[model samples]
Target: MIQIVPIDTPTLGDRSYLVGDGTVAFVVDPQRDIDRVLDLAARHGLRITDVFETHIHNDYVTGGLALARATGAAYHVNAADPVSFDRTPIRDHDVVEVGERMRVRAVATPGHTFTHLSYVLETPDRAPVVFTGGSLLFGSTGRPDLLGPSHTDELVRAQYASAHRLTGGLPDDTEICPTHGFGSFCSATQSEAERSTIGREKQVNPVLTQDEESYVEQLLAGLDAFPAYYAHMGPANTAGPAAVDLAEPRTADPAELRARIDAGEWVVDLRSRTAFAAGHLAGSLNFGLDGSFATYLGWLIPWGTPVSLLGDTPEQVAEAQRELVRIGIDRIESSATGEPEAWSGAAPLGTFPRASFTDLAAVRHHRAVTVLDVRRDSEWAGKHVDGAVHVPLHDLLHRLDEVPRGEVWVHCKSGYRASIGASVLAAAGHRVVVIDDQFDQAENAGLPMTA
Candidate 1:
């Protein structure tokens, strides 16, 4: 019987599955960090026999090539994809034997990408399970616009057809696993579900339920800006990504960090917003390794820019490195770990105060303080302090001067970006206050807000 293990890469909100028959396994849709996949197999006493790629992943680098090479397992990709490297090319209806008794059959399902495919797993006695990588997501389907405007309509039609292809013939009880659209940029809408079946998806998935033309219209209209790094990923995957380097990165003392910072390299602080606000390196930007580190960092940090990491522990640095590398962000120059004061050589460490939104409201004049909302444009348009200066966090570094002079009070939907923004203002030698609270509180408390 096939025992499927879902290895969660929380950083990507993506899952890489291990489908095996107690002896050998096939890892499906793994991220660039292969050690986790390998370690999972080792712990289970199973040898990985193959690594599968459902499509040319755009959000993050694939570990299929690297994992296959490391385990002597064949790497499989769609036969039609224009990959430069050697791989065991697969086609629709092809069945690959994995382990002693488990089998995976490829089903042609194009939508998110031109060559995407979903796989059906059949074990000894259990019902079939379909792994839909970028098509037939839980409540939605993969966005068709990632390939640019030229391909949007064509891919949208293809996506509509692909949705029915699964629901049309598959048994209602067939368990379905989707890799994207669950808080992934590749998805058009976020699927707020962790588990779903073919029957359930047929009832709820937009493409499956709506008229084709209407679905197309809604999808086209809903497309938003995906991560900028997405433009770089397709080319890198097509050219064949190099195996990821998982070795612990080299460390830098404070002097080396200072030189790099002065030389225009990034210094990312991977700590909690609370911890970072207490005190941190003067010029470092706070990304807080706990949140959507890769997505935000990839969005804001320029492509191929060199960076240094400062974290409280080696584990934090290692975790941050893994997330960054998945986006082909391999230019991490150096790292520093432990308490901030342990490392010396920079200007005096700086700090700022975090205030509750209620606290800010209770004490003072809205006109007197400069309240800067650092959320995205969409968020700002939805609701914000009436007199606040709007600067999306991603655009803050470049538009620093646009912020009005005087005490700066920063906020986002939540306190996360507020802390990051506060750090930017603090580093620039401005008096900063992080309005560290929920946006809802500001709105519900009758603070003048305009949507």
Candidate 2:
């Protein structure tokens, strides 16, 4: 009997699977969290024999090579543009044996990227299961526009043919598993249901409903703004990820934390920005403990840096620690164990004042405040508060000098980014106020607008 284990890619909300028969296992599209897969293998007393990358991912880094390196397992990818790091290059019809009862056959599926492929898992008693990387999603399909214009048409045509190959050629009952799910940038249209059957998708998926051209047109129409950081992620994945060292859980006194920070160690405040802005130790960088925390941390902090975590509670600290470990960032020295007591010994960095739209209006009338909008440029263009400076959150770190130090008012669509911006400015000794709400209220009130 074969068992399928689904592991959630916390950052991207994507799913990577581990397939095994209680003796040897195979992992598919292993994300940056290689430890979890290892742990799962250990729990089942199974040895991981293969690590496969269905396609090069853009949203989060892939951990296929890392897992293979750690476990001495073989890493697999398409023969064309074969993954560079000590991997077995697999081509169409290439067979990889897992155990006596299971085998995986590579099937070429190009559309999302120039060299995409899927795996068909053959089991003893059941129909084959297709691991459709980005080719065919639950409700929609992978976008063809990701590949550069030179090969866009060819790739799109290949994608359509690939979809037909799987749906028409494979058994109707073949289980379909995808790399991405709803809310992923990879798939233009994704169903809320993460996994489905080929027959079910053929019957209900709109993209599969139409011919190639119509599908491609619809995909191009609804793409959200891909984050600037995503451009760096894909290439890094192709090259293989650097090893991350996890810090052991140690109870640190406030003096120890301060000494470490004073010694040039990086401190990551893992609480929500709002909580961090409420009151935090001076000089801690704010990246909320929400989605993409590990990804941004990897970018911001150098590998093997002696880092400390500050969370809202003990539970939150543990959660943050586990997330960091998933991405191989294990070098956490210690976490602040208690709240006010934990912070009382440390110097107050500064406070980010909370403001409502009414407060913002009052400040605007005074002419003494500098309003900073930290939402995206497109969001700023949609509408904005009068006399507010446009500085998107991602760029705020680099453009801090552009914001005036006196009486800074930071805001975003809601209060989230504003809170992060406020925390950053406060750490820099700027008097900051984070407007928690009242954007819509202020708009309804017909407050003045500048640009």
Candidate 3:
């Protein structure tokens, strides 16, 4: 029996796969935490003999090198990828055999990156399955602009050709497994479908349906700002990241926590938006554990800043640590888990108010207030509250000077980012109210919206 298991890191919006043929398996695009892959392999009674990288990822630190070292599996990387560590230099059309019936063929499909590859898995009885990684995502293709504008024009054209090449070479029934596009910014556009095949994708995917010119134009038009910390991911992966250290960070006492915050080091509170709004360390920022914590935190913080985590439980701190490492933010200065009072010491906890769009609208009638929209540029461009200053959550910290002086009302598509923005403003001494409601509710609340 053949089993293909997807180990999803929903927090990072990526998936790694473990595929086996009863006795042996191969892993594709594993994350920084390799224990999950080890445990999955053990449960399936499979000895992994090979690990493949479709590309040197730009979004997360890869576990492929560590897993290969631990299991003594052949690490297959593109011969063209300039890396520090030694790997099995695989080229286009190089077929690698697994235990018995399984075989994987590497196809050069450069677009997402110049050295990108897609692996086609073949067996005697079953139809073919292709791991496209960041190349061809469901209903979308990987964004080609990560390398910068100089390479974008060339990469985008190559991306169009690569998509066609895969469809031409593989049968329509071939199953598609990709490493990104489940809320990851790597995808050119988001899709609702959970699973798809070449045939299904051909019918609906913009890359396959539209002409290359049309597809490229639409894709370029839709592209928006990605996380700022993405600047560090490529170099970390190229150097081959060290094995992740998820050990509990040194505990921070109240004095130490206050000291770090006073010194301008990031002391993040990993609680819910509601809890954070009620009370938190005055200077501590809230990148709540409930939302896209790592993405937002990594995006906003100055790179190489000493970060201390404050969470409600040890598990929460550990979870945040795991997510941080995936994005290559490996060093955590310290951590604490308990009530805010314990971490506050003599300092009084700071508080902020959270209201819905209806509340915001009612307040607008009586007084002048600043409305801040912290959604992405694309989202703000699509629709947003009129006269609201737009500073995306990723750019909120650096762009705070642009936010007007008043009782500022903050909101995003949902409440999560609004809370983060509100907290930042609150910490900066701005009287802020978090609009903890959906953006869709704004129209119903009689707020003037730009279409």
Candidate 4:
């Protein structure tokens, strides 16, 4: 009996699979942190024999090369990919046996990337399972535009063909284990379903249900901005990423923290949005641990900028470090784990007002305040508060000059991005009030909205 274990990195919305039939195992799409994989294999009493990557990833750094080297396992990647590191270049239709119970066959599924391959794992007693990396997702396919707009049309059409190719050969009950679409921006759309099969996807997935032209049109229209840091992931993965260092960073004193902030380096606070809004070190930005910490930080921060961390606990700092390393932000210049007072030194902690859409509506009745909407372009185009200044959170730092100087009320679809935006504004010496409420409440609050 083969046991397949999904090692989920929920923070990034990706899953790495570990499959074994008691004695030997293989891994697929492992994250930068390979200790989790090592520990899992140890616990399962299985020796890893192979590591596979479906494509050169563009979201987070790949752990395949490092893991394969560590365990002396054969590292499998697409033969045609222009990677710098040594790898077992497996081509389409190639089959490799893993122990006595399992065999994996490479199937070309070139929608996410031109070289993308989905692996079909077969066992004697059970239905086959396909590890669809960025190819076929649960309800949607991987976004085809990640390689830039030039290849989007070509890839979308290929993506459509790939979905059909997989279903054409596989049984209806073939389990679908995908690498993206949990919450990863790599997916064309987010999916709520936890588990699915080829049969289920045939009944619902856009790539499977719609004609190629229709699917292509809808997919191209729906893509919003992916993380800016994605520009660096592919190159790093192709060159072979180093083993991540999860060690707690060197501790910085309050004065050092202030120095880093004054030098225009990012000093991130990994607390809850509410806690950060209530009191935080002045000039420090909030990309709270409670939300998509790595995603937003990676998206917003100027690439290659020095970063320092302020968390309430060592564990928080450690978690933040793990998240940062996955995105190739390896060096955390320093970190401090303590309260706002301690990090504030002799200075007072800064704070901002947090209110709901009802309060915003009421304020609009009497006075003028800069209403800033920091959602993505698609979101802003769909519906937005009337008379709101639009600036997607990713572009906020560079476009700060466009933000009119005044009492600014910042908001996003949810309050999370709003708090981060508010912190950015407050750090720039603008008076900011975070609209700490859902955007859906705007209608109930009688705030006028425009499409």
Candidate 5:
């Protein structure tokens, strides 16, 4: 009997799979935390004998090499990639055997990355499952623009060829399990389905239906701005990222934390947005350690900056660090759990002013405050406040100077990003009023809407 266990990292919205044939298995696209895969293997009485990566990932570090080293398993990557470490270089139609009857056939499907591949896992009682790393996603394919503008056309064309290659050769009932497109920024688009099949894709995926030129144009046009941290991932992976050290980080007391911050270090507060708003270290930034913590932290903080973590509990601090290391932000100088004010023996920062959509509606015409919509350009284009200043959260710091000189009110699709923006503004000495409410409230409250 063959068993396939999925290990999903929800924070980054990617899935890694463990395929076993009773006694042995191989892992596909494992994340930095290898323990999860180990636990799955342990439960099933399967020893992981091999590991595979579809591509050098853009969003997080890969656990392939590290896992291989840990387990004495053969690690695989594309032969074309100039990787620094030792790995089995796989090519089109290459076959790998992990168990008595379980095998994986590598299919060269370069699109998302120049060195991408899709693997077909063959086992006892299933047709087959194709692990489409970033090349082929649910309905949409991975974005070709990740490599850079110069490489986009070349990659997009390759994406077109790769899509056909998978759909044409594979059986219609073949399971399509992709690693991207599940809310990760890596996908060009998203699909609602929990699982996909080759037949369903042939009937629905536009690349299979449209002309190459049309498909390329559509894919390119739909491309969204990715996080700034993405640039570091490709290089980090190619150079062979180190295995994550998942120890509960050494706890630091208040004085050590305060001294580190005083010497020009970053202190990230990973508390609830409400908790952060209530009280946090004066110079510390609130990333909330939720939904999009990894992306926003990597995007907003200067690269290579050593950071310390502060949270309400040890569990929260550990969770925040786990997410941070995935994006190559492992230069953690210290970590601690406590009230923000107690961390430094100084009073925590004051809570910024907040107002609801209805309250802000009455004051919309006031020349005293500017309503800043910090959503993406697409969101802003579809609808936003009539007289609001537009600046996407990712670009806010660089363009902060462009904001008008006055008190500012900030909001995103929800309260999450608004809290982040509000913190940044407050830290910068600008007066900020957080409109910590849902965007839908804006329309019902009779606020101005512009499309």
Candidate 6:
């Protein structure tokens, strides 16, 4: 029996799959975190046979070449536009046999890119499975407009033809496995579900239903701002990511931690937003352990910047270090040792300006206070505190002039971005406070708020 394993892409709702016949396996569209894939293959007693790239991904870095180098597996991409890497290039109609029962047939599926392909796995007694890559997604199709101005009508038409070729020719029972889930930028209408079938997609996916012209128009219409970092990631993936081989994190004693901090080394607090808000080292930046941990770390901290992580547990510290390495930020010194002892005599702990109903009521009595809500516009519209100014954190850098120069209270759902916002405001010499608690705390406290 063949097995398919999904590797989670943290922060982004993306997934990559490993398919094999127990003894030998192949990986498709691997995310930057390759250890999980390697561990999965070892646990199942399978040797990695090949690494395949469906297309150049724009969100997270691809781990295809990295995995191939580590496992000595042959890397494969379409020969039409061969990936400039050290690998074996396969063409259309090429067959890669995995075992007696399973074989991968590479079918050129373009439109998402000039050189995109989907691999179909054929097995006896079961319908073939199509690793659609970005060409076909559940309830949607990959955007044809990612190529920018080069994505003219001709390219869009080519993409439509590619979608038709796959959906029109594939067996109804063939499973459709995609690299990205819902909320990914690769496809406009990415489904929240990680995986779906060809039959299910044919019924609901609008891009598949439309004629060629309409499909192109619909895809181009929804193209929003692509991340600035995407341009660099494709080339990085095509070449290969640098290997991360740091030793196990050694926790620093208080004296050592202070020395590093005083020497101007960055101290990254890896606890949850709430924990960091409760108490953290003075002047340290708090980046929580939720989604986008690595991406944001790479964005905020320069490459090779010496970083010391402070987390609730040793496991969290290790996870943070691994994530940083995924994006090529690899100058980690060590995690803070004796988390409790390190805090001793560090500085007086300061609370994030959490507003209970009573606190909000007290603030409401003051006529000169301003509540700045740093949440996305969509989130603010869905629900929000009354009379709060909605300025999304990403846009805050440019729109700082819009915020009132008064006693300002910054807030988000919790105090993560709000704390960052508060620090930004404080740096600008504004009187600022961060509320890092649930909104209900204010309501339950009978604090007056407008919708």
lDDT per residue (tens digit) for residues 1-451 in model 1: 5678988776676777988777888888988888888888998888998888989988888888888889999888999998999999999999998866877899999889999999998876987899999888888888888888899889999999988987787888899888786578788888678889988887887888899999999887777677788888888888888787767889998888877777777899999999888888877888998788888888878777798899999999988988988989976788999988765554677788889777777655534888899987767777788888999888887899999888888999889888878887886778999988889999666678787
- Model 5 misplaced stretches (Cα beyond 4 Å): 253-256, 365-367
The estimated TM-scores of all candidates read: 0.94, 0.79, 0.99, 0.99, 0.96, 0.83
What number of clashing residue pairs does each candidate have, in the order they appear?
0, 8, 0, 0, 0, 4
Question: What TM value does model 1 have?
Answer: 0.94
Using lDDT, give the best candidate's number: 4
Q: How far does residue 17 in candidate 4 sit from its true spot (Å)?
A: 0.3
Candidates, ranked, lDDT: 4, 3, 5, 1, 2, 6
Tens digit of per-residue lDDT, candidate 6, span 125-225: 68889988778888877776666776656666776787778878888888988876556667766566656777887777776777767777777766654
Worst 10 residues of 1 by lDDT: 358-367
How accurate locally is residue 145 in candidate 4, as Cα lDDT from 0 to 100?
95
| Tens-digit per-residue lDDT, 339-361, candidate 4 | 88999899999999999999999
lDDT of 5 by residue, 420-439 (tens): 88888877778888888999
lDDT of 4: 0.95
lDDT of each: 0.85, 0.76, 0.92, 0.95, 0.86, 0.72
Model 3 TM-score is 0.99
lDDT of 2 by residue, 264-371 (tens): 687778877666767677777677876467655654454567878877777877777766654455567877755634654746554566878887776666687888
Model 3 poorest 10 in a row by lDDT: 187-196
Query: Which parts of model 6 have CA positions greater than 4 angstroms off?
Result: 80-84, 143-159, 211-227, 249-266, 298-306, 337-346, 356-362, 377-390, 397-406, 413-416, 423-431, 435-451
> Deviation in angstroms for 449 in model 5?
1.9
Find the number of clashing residue pairs for candidate 4.
Answer: 0
lDDT of 5 at 23: 89
Candidates, ranked, TM-score = 4, 3, 5, 1, 6, 2
